[model samples]
Target: TEPLEKLMPIDGYEDMPLVPLDIAVEPLVSSISGIHIYAYSAKERCKNPPADDLTIDESASIMLYSMDSKFGNKSLHVILNEILKSADKNKLEPWLLYLKLFLTALSHLPSTRRQVYRGIKLDLSKEYPVGETIVWPGFSSCTTSINFVQSELFLGSAGPRTIFSITCYLGKYIGNHSYYSSENETVIFPPTQFKVIDCLNQGNGLHIIQLQEIQPCFSHLHAPVFSSISKKPSSKLTFNSVVNHNTKWKQRGVTLTKHHSRGPKPDCLYLPYGVYVDDNQTIYIADHGNNRVMAWKYGATSGQLIAGGNGSGFNGSGCETNQLNKPINVVVDRRRNHVFISDSGNMRVVRWPCENGTNGEVII
Candidate 1:
């Protein structure tokens, strides 16, 4: 070992007091039953366990019970009232409880509405299994897949909230061969149906599930939306007439992409590749050909050069913050108040302290 006095400090290291092993082990030992250890990775939040995988029904039931457990009742109104009281008292439980409620709401439509609740399970652990059984209350063996949507842990609140997405089959079954016929025509349907379930976990016993019926389209999951057309009723038009109507649009096609003049000036942008806009309506553009990143404010005529605008060249790439070699993308971290750049040509990613800061530190 080298002399302690001669040792240089690391880039992100500092001395701190040592922690006692007993003190660290106290919480782990105290909550062993509730502590279902998950192998957390940088790539995933809450990965499913290999053995004894929890079903959608089990997840939803756990979520509902967790809500009831928190508020001591199943009534949402009472829960909301408790949350409001806690919030008024400046307590954190209400915020956490409300978040769980929000997560539960996203699981499915509320019980107040007219919904067809086919299967209901009081005991989730005994009722739900991994395969060939009822995965959720109204869903069963047809569960095709379970996907992870998003998971987040909020500070100033009690616990972490994790949400999962699941897809299952909801097949249609006919008891007899009798078919109902309409006045105009008879409609025959396939025997299989599918639905999507959104499951939320409060990192405790409470779990909530929201379910939505998946409709059959042209093999596409998401339905297309048209802004100009109304869903209720519309007038019919010929194919040629509709084509001609669309061609007569009088709006400016390109806004920011259009340039006032064509040159590598302070105002003129060249071969703009990646663009990102922050919450403040500030646009960060990676002008690849110019080898620079420009920060343009909303409605501004010209942008101020943020990084590497000193005449494009791979030779200009260096460890210096001002130097960038053909940047490809830019992202602004609003929380950290920093702008990150993908300096592709330099083969390294860099980030600036602020929007107008001079020097940037290489990150990746």
Candidate 2:
């Protein structure tokens, strides 16, 4: 069978209207033997997806593929991908119904934008040269864990391993719905292409290949339907919780701010009114009684005064641009790189630089 690399076009699958799970994959049952049983079971397991755009049936159809079933050596995924890679268009007829429904479901899944990992038990470094584009023309299975590929359960430690570090922007994160939910699997659909960044041999049989997912000149699959309402059902596992272990899922947390514990002074929270956390985990708080906005970076004890801190000249009055009068709210304009302070006591809103500004300008 020809490989499905470089956006290999399988005819007629994309145009077929999506059908229900029980019937859409029925054509495959004749060829695959026991797929009907798996389809029924997969539907039962995926009655409700973590997102809303796809129907229960569409989600279940996808879950069937996402199951990564293996029986008597050949899995459903392996067979499906093999035929997709074939240059002959006639082989795609039996798969049309299932492919349409499957692709439709994948289109509803919100694209996960981050680095994902996959490993192969070969030295395929020569295949992917730096500055070249490679395509995986099937539902490409990848995991987000670096540890999984290295573990004894997977590729193992002592073997020829080619670790693909992929920066994917259109991959569907389906671990939450997959039967193997703990594996943190992300599926990259057909038309998935990558630009090889670099490939290096890390001695002893290990090779690391870096690839970045690139968009084709035209889209092969339909546009995503769930891009606007991206919030998943309450059960979806977030990327943060997937990577790092959570302790209070252990039920204990140490204090973060400890410079001046409790008082109406600098770095102290005297009825702190508003708090905003940035992408860098910088905490901006409007210290109500202290008349100041404090910025605390991650793992910092003492906070730096960013918006307003009243010293000798504007202690009570707080009319100085360098000070505030009962700052009750604080928000940061990340694009402008400035903090907007609500000077409640002075009845004005002030905008100040969040980093090292000693003065503020009243905006409203």
Candidate 3:
């Protein structure tokens, strides 16, 4: 449909757009930042990819390594059958190795096991389960491996242990060493005062277990065992059993603040609301009534003023960066070495670069 001149130019595009032969054309590989081209694939769409498909030779090698008669031919057969069905080869070797290590660790445990079981039936599902969703506000990240002591191992005062279980969080092993990602933050849950409400298997080799804080008084009778046995009477009035239910806390009923008496002093706190402790045992307290934030060093008698302390009462809003109205909550950013505070009365949240900083920047 085009004219002869247009048709000629269209047909001659290859020759017309040709570069001069004398011109030096730099190759793409010669560039400082080389061009990266990627090919799209379907594997990217998976949530928990089955990357455990191993070669026949690798599977045979694993079977050879597990040639112990104690492992039983039936167990090996089930494992091999599952491998043929859908067991991920990538997870196989590590899991097998960890299984051997876990058994060894179990044998090395200090406590004597009252009971033990052999194995359970393996039910392979085509896909992982899906369920309800819950949100954890303050948690930053999830840990890979969580270890815990048997609940029966913990013993409380009065010789009546109420602890159902004790759990621990540990890092996963990579070769001969264990690896913990320091780039992400770690969460601390208060001990002897929490209950697991629900547990969700995330299907990605991870589980999300929700914990709720509960009173320490709620406990079942688990056959009392005491580390320090005495012929002394088990009366509540005695020094050995001061209360019917006593926690194993070192500072049984001692208050860190107001060791002498309750008052607004360099060593005492007035209406303290927020508290944070660093790894070095340094304490940061937001003394709300005193209109100040205080930092107490480890074993120090008095606290040094970090923010505010001008005067009590809501007489005037602070006009300076260091002044605070009434801080109610405090948090520490360990990675950045910063302290954050909820300046409640001032209707703002602020952060200081360092623990001993005089001035703070408004966050909200």
TM-score of each predicted structure versus truth: 0.30, 0.58, 0.30
Cα lDDT tens digits, model 3, 1-364, are: 0011101001111111111110001121132121111001111221121112221112222222222222323433234323322323442331332222222222222222121111111211112122322211111122222321112222112221112111323211111111122212122111123344454543433334444433434221121222111111111010112112222336554345544224457886754655666666666777765777777777787987877775432323545667776565667677998878767656578898655687888878
Badly placed stretches (over 4 Å) of model 1 are 1-254, 260-264, 311-319
Error of 1 at 3 (Å): 67
Q: Tens digits of per-residue lDDT for model 2 on 1-364?
A: 2142565455676555444465567567667888878988987787454344556556676678876677457888788777767676677798887877677677667797988988888888888889988777767888999898778888787778898999999998877667787789888977788899999898878899999999875544554323211133221111111112221222674454444333445545643556677777776877655678888777777777787665423323546777787565677888999988867667578899978798999798
Candidate 3 deviation (Cα RMSD): 29.1
Error of 2 at 208 (Å): 0.9
lDDT of 1: 0.37
Query: Which of the two, 1 or 3, has more lDDT?
Result: 1
True lDDT of residue 282, candidate 2: 74
lDDT of 1 by residue, 1-364 (tens): 0011111111110111111111111233232222112101100221222112322221222232222222223332233333232313343222332223222222222212112222122213222222321112111211111221121211122333222122323332111110111111111111112233444444453333444434443220111212211111111100111121123334663245445233457677754646676666667777765778888776777888887765444433444667776576777787898878877666678887655777778788
Of the candidates numbered 1 and 2, which has the greater lDDT value?
2
Residue 176, candidate 2: how far off, in angstroms? 1.9
Please give the distance, in angstroms, between residue 98's alpha carbon in candidate 1 and its true position after superposition: 50
